[model samples]
Target: MTELLNLFIVFAKIGVCTFGGGYAMVPILERELAEKRGWAESTELLDWYAISQAMPGIIAVNVATFFGCKRRGVIGGIVATLGMVFPSFVIILAIAAVLNNFADVPQVKSAFAGIRACVVVMIITTVLRLWKTSVADRPAIAIFVPIFALSAFTGVPLALLIVASGVAGVAIGAVRQGRGK
Candidate 1:
């Protein structure tokens, strides 16, 4: 019971504070789960994020579920997911009700503009942090550069790109292993 409450509190805190969505949550997750609580390592958190991205759902929820299950099994996953989602759900509902009434308010418009700018900055920070780990070597760059260009420039689906990247990673690993042996 205590463990469940703690998990709920921790995830609720993260979910409530997180803005700009999943990538922006990465640093906060690292701080709370890895550095503060010792619940997970940085690498493990990264792995969760990667896997969560590949899965067909919201990345933040997926990460919460993964970590919750890792810590306390299936029920924990449910608790954590609810913790992460509940605050957002309530907030969004309240905002929807209010924003509809104040759609033309200058203060609201300015506030949203400011938030969008902050979101952009947060995303850039996330990209830089992810780059250090993801594009560490030549092969990583090889895989990253082309797909990045294609994703940015063309009409290719992100899921397809993710699959292609995974395949390339596997093929690279296998080839490296074969060479070593």
Candidate 2:
């Protein structure tokens, strides 16, 4: 009971404070879940983040579900997910009510522009932090380079790339195991 309440409050705070969606929430998630509460280790959180990105639905929601389940099972997952999404739901509803009125205001427009810039920075920071943790070994680098190139230059879909990478990883692991045997 107590754990569920804590999960709800923490995720609600995250959802309320973060303005730029999932990427913007990453730093806050890391700080609260890893550093402040010690709910998860930094490396584990990074791993969860990576997996969340690859999974269906929003990254933030998926991460919250993962953490919640880890901490308090299926009920916890529900509580955490609701907590993370509730704020956005309320905020969007409120915004919808007054957005038309505020849309033409120059000050509001300028503030939005500033927020967008900050969002970009937050996303870049998340990318750099993830890269440091994810691209450590030779096999990861080997897989990352070509996939990155293909995605950057060609029009390869991210889902397809991730699938291909998974296949490659499995094959490489099999080969290594065979050699050791």
Candidate 3:
């Protein structure tokens, strides 16, 4: 019970604070769960982030669920997921109730614009940090460049790109392993 409450509080803080979405939440999770609390390592959090992004549903909630399940069981997953989602649900409901009146206000508009800018910066920082660790060799670079370009320019589906990249990585790894034998 105590652990469940702690999980809820930790994820609730994450839920309330994170602005842009899953990518934006990564750094905060790294700092709070990994660096401060020692719940998991930064690399483990990044892996969960990747998995959560690939899976359906909200990334933040997915990561929280994964952590919770890993820590305890189904109940932990439930608590963590609720913790992560509860704040957003309440906040959005409140915002929806009030946004129509304030949506046009210049200050509100400016504040949102500033928030978007910050989200962009946060996403870029997270991607750069992940890239430093995830993309290490030429084969990975080869897979990354065209996928990035296609995702940026073309209308190719991101899921397909991710799967293709995974397949390419597996093939590269297998070939390298065979050569070493």
Candidate 4:
């Protein structure tokens, strides 16, 4: 019960504090859970982030669920998810109640612009870190470049691309192994 409360409080703090959604939450998570709590390393958290993104739900909730389950069990996952969403639920209600009146104010607009800028920087930093770790070899780069291009410039569905890339990577690894090198 005490551990469950602690999990709720921590995830609630993370929920209320994070802006720009899941992508922006990565660095914050790295600092809190990874560096400070020492529950996981930054790279390990990144792996969870990747898996969470691929899951069919909100990434933040998925991440919280992952951490919670890892810590305790299914009940912990439920508690953590509720904690992670509670703040956002209240905040959105409050914002929606007041935002219409101030939506056009120059000050509010400027503040939003600043927030967007910060979010972009956070996202870019995470992406760069992911790239550094993920695209380390020629085979990985070969997979990344075309996938990036297709995702960026073409109408290719990402699920297909991901599947194809997985197959390609496995095939490449098998070929290398067969060559005894």
Pick the lDDT winner.
1
Candidate 4 residue lDDT tens string, 1-181: 9999988998999997788778678877777787788876666776676576556888899999989988889998999899999998997788898876666899988988898898788767867876777778899899888988998899986667766877898999899999996
Report each candidate's C-alpha RMSD, comma-separated, in the order given: 2.4, 2.5, 2.1, 2.6
Q: Write one digit per residue (lDDT tens) for candidate 1, span 1-181.
A: 9999999999999998787788778878877998788999777887787778778999999999999999999999999999999898888898798767564889987987887788677667766876887688999999979987998899997778887888999999999999999
Assess each prediction's global lDDT (C-alpha) against the native. 0.86, 0.83, 0.83, 0.82
lDDT score, residue 126, model 2? 65
The TM-score, computed over Cα atoms with residue i paired to residue i, of candidate 1 is 0.83
Off by over 4 Å in 2: 152-154
Q: Which structure among the candidates has the greatest TM-score?
A: 3
Cα distance off (Å), candidate 2, residue 21:
3.2
What shift in Å separates residue 54 of candidate 2 from its native position after superposition?
A: 4.4
Of the pair 2 and 4, which is ahead by TM-score? 2
The TM-score of candidate 4 is: 0.80
When summed lDDT is taken over every stretch of 10 residues in candidate 3, the lowest stretch is 46-55
Clashes per candidate, residues 3 or more apart or on different chains: 0, 0, 0, 0
Sliding window of 10 residues with minimal summed lDDT for model 4: 46-55
